[model samples]
Target chain A: MTSWLPTLQTATPEDGYDLAVKLARVAVKATQPDAAVRDRLRPEYAEDADALIAVSHVVATHFATVAAANNYWRNRT
Target chain B: MTSWLPTLQTATPEDGYDLAVKLARVAVKATQPDAAVRDRLRPEYAEDADALIAVSHVVATHFATVAAANNYWRNRT
Candidate 1:
């Protein structure tokens, strides 16, 4: 098996977001390792508005999970 | 204007990924604040394979950006 996750950490909200995106991608790669397959499928959704919005929802879900983990990035100076 | 980004910090890669997803969603929300519009559009993409894959790509792109910020989480014990 491949190592999908590394020691996760972030210093800013932007960093957190970037890591979240990576995690999402890593999940997809784990589910489907073939890049060609993903590439072939990309165009279909790329142009669709509905698909784009759906993507945002997925990202948001991931973000919420991350926020919980970091306690919403609270308790810092 | 809505503040999409809060003080970001993560303690694990998973946390970072979650934040990344949140960032992506925040971007979308910023672009389109109307929740009803996003909800209506989600189903169309949710059921489509291409759209789903596209979502993964978007997430991956975000991850890559995050990874760079964290130096690929490289220098940590």
Candidate 2:
């Protein structure tokens, strides 16, 4: 039971996508206990899947780039 | 990233609810390994939230009724 549960209980199908995205963000927190990931979802709370997916892609890409940079540093050293 | 990811990637916002519902079912399976709950979601896979909420209400009502019945039987004995 979340703060959004009441709204979800009352939302129309047109609004269901937004509600579902909110639930999905909550579900991600509920599933993945990673604080960093949780932080990523917070500001994006009102965002739809397109926005969330785009942010996720950015986060993942940044992480991959960082990892690649570290690997490059290790190889150089 | 399950079998539905490909479809989700391509689905319009109109289809996102159904897709999100599908993902929610998979997520419940992924999250809750309870076979009985899993079974409940299975038959209702294609159902929308309205349909799911209805079935869930029915199941909960039936469960509560059975529990009440058992309590009554015990009290009588």
TM-score of each: 0.49, 0.24
> What tens-digit string does per-residue lDDT give for candidate 2 at B10-53?
12333433443343333233334466754554555435565455
Looking at model 1, give its docking quality level. Answer: incorrect
**Chain B in candidate 2 has what TM-score?**
0.35
Can you write out model 1's per-residue Cα lDDT over A1-77, one digit (the tens) per residue?
77655545556555666566566566767788999998887656554565555656566556555655655556557
Model 2 clashing residue pairs (backbone): none
- Candidate 2 residues A1-77, lDDT tens each? 46656633322222332343444456466788899977775545322323323333332223223323333122221
lDDT of each: 0.61, 0.37
Cα shift from native, residue B10, model 1 (Å): 20
TM-score of chain A of each: 0.77, 0.34
The clash count for each model shown is 15, 0
Per-prediction share of native contacts kept: 0.25, 0.00
Candidate 1 regions off by >4 Å? A1-4, B1-4, B8-77
